[model samples]
Target: MALAAFGQLNMEEPPPILGSRSVDCFEKLEQIGEGTYGQVYMAKDKKTGEIVALKKIRMDNEREGFPITAIREIKILKKLHHQNVIHLKEIVTSPGRDTDDQGKPDNNQYKGGIYMVFDYMDHDLTGLSARPNLRFPVPQIKCYMKQLLTGLHYCHANQVLHRDIKGSNLLIDNEGNLKLGDFGLARGFSHDHDVNLTNRVITLWYRPPELLLGATKYGPAIDMWSVGCIFAELLNGGKPILPGKTDPEQLTKIYELCGSPDENNWPGVSKMPWYNQLKSPRPLKRRVREICRLFDRHALDLLDKMLALDPSKRISAKDALDAEYFWTDPLPCDPKSLPKYESSHEFQTKKRRQEMRQNEEAAKKQKLQHPQQQQHGVGQTHAASHWPAGPNHPMHNAPPPQLSHAGGPSGHHYYQNPHGGTPGPNRYHPNGNQSGGYNNQSRGGYSSSGSYPSRGRGAPYGVGPPNYSQGGGQYGRGQNPIAGGARNQQYGWQ
Candidate 1:
């Protein structure tokens, strides 16, 4: 009884590690990423020779020693322990050039490079999805989804909100085990009646309706919406569900797919400032299943509940784990049994991102050089949207004519239409006598413009049917004449 009393009286906080144990402890490798708050590096621990990711918390001009956000994240991550959650091993400070010969850290003259060491991950979800060759089978996708939900369940149970949930924040090792990462936007909640949260936490595409409508008080439902969006993205060729240009357009896109919100559907939606202001009462259209025909009924049902317009009605993570989608055919594979992908995801992502940066730089230079001439036309960049409907389309049910192309460009390689003549004064024969994308003077399709795409696939870039020609048979001045013209040229494949 006396020892217990003495221990209770003498309890104290652990000593603060004001400096690193040694300057040469970690071998600094190449920088992996740079963000608004800090930079991450791939480093090696000299003592253990273990590879790790070191995130440098930037404390450039703050009179305060360490960043408050960093401190908060560290505190929260230390309490979390799960197979699907990133592990924070330790925190250490790197001594700057101002240190003495003995490598003692000097706070006054030293640049504080406080680092948070984390478990090494081979790739992020975004990088893995971006790989041209790697494909996520149905079982693999289910496995990933299960892991994500499991991690999110743990966080919500601990009263922590992972406000920023996106593909890039999920890390995966070589063994196909996925782990939740990027705690910079995470926040802890106290067990009290009042809890205030910022609405501008998630990425624009993954944001839910409540948050988009300026909701400041929210719960785990906010994350469930992101899970739905991520699931949809995984099924739909790794593209965002709602890619809108502006906030209003984004809301409109949501309404178009999920049906517009009424007070009965989404309680308190009419009170939102953005409700009646976006499109002045457009009709609600529901076509989510039609758009995502790849998913089965059970998967669709789970996604519907997860993406409910009413936040109160959204399914919780624990509930989602019990959905019938998981117990269906093509059962979720074990993480260790999943296919092993190359660790080249990081390099490929960096290369693609660098190329995109270069393209943006080039576009900026072009705009600066000729703002008057080429004023950012979306039609030129995205030609697929403007292509004619397919042969089976209701409005375009006419059987197409047999078409062929040669391997050379000439001054007069005109089409041999049913009119049985070279393109001339009478190019328009309205009665089903049309040839594919015409006005050809070619060794290839376009000499001064567009490249001649190779054959093998059926209709390279949705090459229009033979009946796409309008009343005026002569190709117009601004016409896109090539059958399989340029589309998403920046990305390597179709």
Candidate 2:
């Protein structure tokens, strides 16, 4: 009965017009992931046989016309052109079902839907990092970081801010290229910091302290703080450096890692609207160098600047590119030099982790039931039977299945280094210093992007997006421009 009901419901639904010029150009393969605003599917272009990702725009509850977030994303993508940035190929739409008196389509009726087309990527950074036993070497980490900073630099130069920067937002192809995606939370900003903006943006874990303290007017420094979180995650073996469950908890984590902010270190912190409401009860000593002692001296130095308590003191993406970490030994390798891996997505990995946990729980229950089952031998066999392939399993010993990233089986080899050896610590360091960065607690830190324009003593703030409903914000609206000296150091990159 349930099956018949389901079939009837499906039959009553209107069939999607699949062969028209709009949505008919491509065939959806499968659902790859979901985002804040809509679902994403793997698709293939019929004309060119090229694989792509189709991001469907959600308009189910919108009484208004097209979504403002989608409009802003489209506008910003059309203006941005960079290798590390995700490219927006074109948008396709389906026709609505409404008709008028003469049987003609209703002019006022909204379109059936829209899909944002993009190049298909095999994995996101989070998924790739979650693969069992997979560890990223120092050079590979540098390669990814450099690409991330480069893309962010481009966005800042163009006066755009990617408020949400997280592991899943960073897409990675089999060839090792990393492209920044998910620009829904992004907005444009003017150089004058007089306008009020929302601080309720950016993922909690990667959000900066300024935003937590309720700063309405901000700049590119917020994005740079996210970059710092990502950098620390990579260095800490793919685990998020600050995984806070709530806004209050997230702020606490920041205060714990970094020292409590004060007027001395952060000139205007005490004046922030939420400073008193969210400020730490007691001052916390700066423990960055203490906790991250294993990290490279140069990398820690850059991280310190990136995660500075004061937004004005934070490093810009352009200046980050020139940091000593990139210039040190075990230099960043070419993206193409990285190894090829199976297709992985955060959605898939989370499911797998859940399954593993369930299996373990089942095994524990079985052991509890058969407590006397030879005191060990039979229980071991039972648990092994329920386990997924382990290191000793035949499935685990077999060669990893290759993916057709470029075209065919041969294309899987394209990600392999053309040189004699793989680009990793083993190829460069004989002692295997890949995991030795925090071997001791003795290290010193000091340091500090297409960045904002150089500001003098009386200049304005970084450019921000214009005020629109949901997408745009007004600039220089009956407000004073921020002091120039504080922000001048941020845009020092000439």
Candidate 3:
């Protein structure tokens, strides 16, 4: 069945050349892997003749034409050039191509697509862990753990959060230096910012208590939890410590090993949105011994601190790297001197292609099952005719347009209250008016007072006008649109 699927994949086009104006610098060798939104290929540079990996993304799969996560990764990678993180070389995009009835490229065909170029990595941590004859000694394990922490520290130091930290995302070079890969789940943090409001990030297995409980406001501590799990996995030959089939089961496993959390351990535990419903107040039970018996007592101690039930008490990545276990005699092996594995690339390629075929088949089944729905899934159509380009269009390089309203600055206008205090029933505008352009007005506009009506009274003070509507404010007449010195305040706006 897999062979038949592969045979149907229209391989006639000689695996689209990497440098056909759609991409430069690299020459396509073979398909290596397929991600949720893109295809990855092994390629070599045309100019430097250096081997590299090229990732091609289908614009149609992204609502904004480019995935925001992908954009975020690129932005973070561009600024973070470190030895531990994967290096991003360049980005290329090509216009859509016109093809003849026979599917051959027509002379007038406009070729356009998006491609990302990255440094070539021989294998990932998952492959290494699965090798039958390979046994990771304690010293070698320590080296990998230290390297992982070093890379993690680099990310955290730069105020970046790697929400997804797992073996598959850890890339290995020929020298065995494990560099952190996959910034798709990373987010930048601003100093003084307390919590992140996005709870739906990170894989379930590696997710921390804060995330599993639906706490949007979290911190780097979330990533630290995953690091701890990765550390345990490295020590135990790549086995997850708290592997669970469901969210509740996963939390149960975590509670069993670390014991239940409390205010004493996690000061802000009770304040979390899901705090009341969790089993937090229950008596502590479960022993760490049942998890991994081979872990040395000192290593177990470090793991205990790292996998603390209370995020506030969990050891930071920096602290974990400094643990005495790492410095003990028979110290960690140098990454450069590690032994190399035989060709696993072909196996990886075949496995990835099979997964891609399965995914495509599943997508086709979904389409057939939901024929009544819109023919194009949320982001399926890629034809240029359906994608209109404008200044505000996500694909365009122009800034969003400015909007104006009566009684406010012509540059950008919004409705406000006349009482010079909170907005009244008649002073609200349902649609938002901004300097760039008008958003759904019914959604409500920012107040000159610099508070969002939709946000609770105790909500953190924001910089610009309120983004959404909440309490006290109503939809109606636009007044007091400009607040005194509201624009000059630079609090949450930045």
Candidate 4:
């Protein structure tokens, strides 16, 4: 079902799908992608050794039988026989072991192990388009678009509305054939004009103005608009034409580019539920020629028709396939002739490699910024243990401040001498006093009141250890600390 609303429309239930293959029949490998209804795994069939994607259906709250989404998908996929659409090979399950009085097998565990096997695709349109190294050429783009439109045409002919049409849902096998996959959000378009459908279906970026304005009776025009977006993205090297961040922003961007719609363009647009919320300002419209100048006239024309703001004006998938753009030069190439790639998981590989590179660069910068910090941090740890009483130890966060030695101003950085131990308060007074070690505050060795308490003897009031109360400054004893600087005298700098 549609992730944002009720999916399938009222219709006769399709035939029940039955399968004999058990879960053990396929060897589970790595997970590839996930969906709203199930987790898809890349598995190998034990009997045929054929690689396939197995979608495990979530059977929670299934008192009403299987999920509507799975059921609809199984029914629709089984009937669709187009090569442009992903083929649902079969259904498989695990009945578990017997747990009954008569030794009969209870299939309760089978609920969690049901799988929908599908043909293995080598890549998806989203993944391939995201490959930084792969730029889709004109012919390649045309080829993919042809296949996409052809599939959509088949779906439309069968009255199946693929509401969720995005690049990731388009799978590509090794032969380069593109197939429409993921029908969970698909539903039959009722011919009854009175029946109303949910407006919310396609992804925000791909959603049309009609849906954005809250119209609930939209038709195939909604999907055509998404196709237009995909077409532009493929041509412009993967950059979406309108990559808005929110619903309001998406509407604004769309209106800004397509020109504001009114009764003349989209009849009764203002009457839509959300119209007043995001009133169109009727801003200047952005033409395809200006936005996608690289596209030739015919291609641009087709793009314009597909992106027509009015649903009635938009081209049908069948008609689009017959557009002049396909008949023009650099014609659509054969899908089989397209370049072959490694595993369909190339997108994931490229993403992880990019993340690894970023992490490595960040690590290098950190090392350069703090080369020897680790070793210094270790030494500080050892020092912290030895001094236990040491004030605010360093954990390599940053270098410590400076302090002058009480023995005298023999040189700067007396505190840097690791063997000499910390200077000032730590060395002068065990009580962490001369507290203002560097700023020279109270209890500090430097005198105040513009005068020193000179002992007028061998060692000037030196009262600590190593040279405490004993040895004088480097100048020895009985000498004036300074020969005399009037400036030093005035500022009491000494």
Q: Pick by TM-score: which candidate is best?
A: 2
lDDT of 1 at 367: 49
Which 10 successive residues of model 1 have the least lDDT summed? 408-417
Q: Against the correct fold, how does model 3 do in TM-score?
A: 0.63
- Whose lDDT is higher: candidate 1's or candidate 2's? 2
The backbone clash count of each candidate, in order, is 6, 21, 21, 4
Q: What residue pairs clash in candidate 1, if any at all?
A: 408-443, 409-442, 409-443, 409-444, 410-442, 410-443
Which stretches of candidate 4 lie above 4 Å from their native place? 1-13, 61-64, 96-111, 345-494
User: Could you give candidate 4's per-residue lDDT for residues 1-494 as a string of tens digits?
Assistant: 22222333334555455667787777766666543444556677787767777777766446777787777777787766676777777888767542222334434444335778787776777656544335566666777997798778778766788876766678876555777877877877754645688875666667788887888887788899999988876765555566654678777888777888777777877788988888766556655556565566777789889999888889998678667776555566655456666553423433444455555556566657665654566557653333223233222112112422211111111001111111111111122211111111221221121121223211111111221111222111233233323212321111
Of candidate 2, the 10-residue stretch with the lowest lDDT total is 408-417
| Best candidate, lDDT | 2
Put the candidates in lDDT order, highest first. Answer: 2, 4, 1, 3
TM-score of each: 0.66, 0.69, 0.63, 0.67
Write one digit per residue (lDDT tens) for candidate 1, span 1-494. 12312101111223246445553587766555555455566667788777777776666646866666676677777766666788777887766642322345434444646777787776677666655533466667778997798778778777777876777677887666778887777877543527767776665666787777777778888889989988886765465576554566667778888888887677788887656666337668666766665566777888888878888899988777667776565566666565445443333354444455555556566546655555446666654443323221222112222221210010010000011111111111233212211111221121221122222211111111221112221111234222222211211111
lDDT of 2 by residue, 1-494 (tens): 12223101212232233324576577776666653455677677788877777777767657787788777777777666666788777788767642222345423335677778787777778767756556577767888998798778878877788887877778887666888887887887766888889997776667898988889999999999999998987887665666665667778999999989998888989999889999999999988888888788999999999999999999999788767787665566666567767676665554554455556666666667756763656547765554334322122112222222211111001111011111111111122233424332322211111021113211011213211121111111233224334322333323
The local distance difference test score of each candidate is 0.58, 0.65, 0.55, 0.60
Looking at model 4, residue 90 earns an lDDT score of 83
lDDT of 1 at 269: 83
Better of 2 and 4 by lDDT: 2
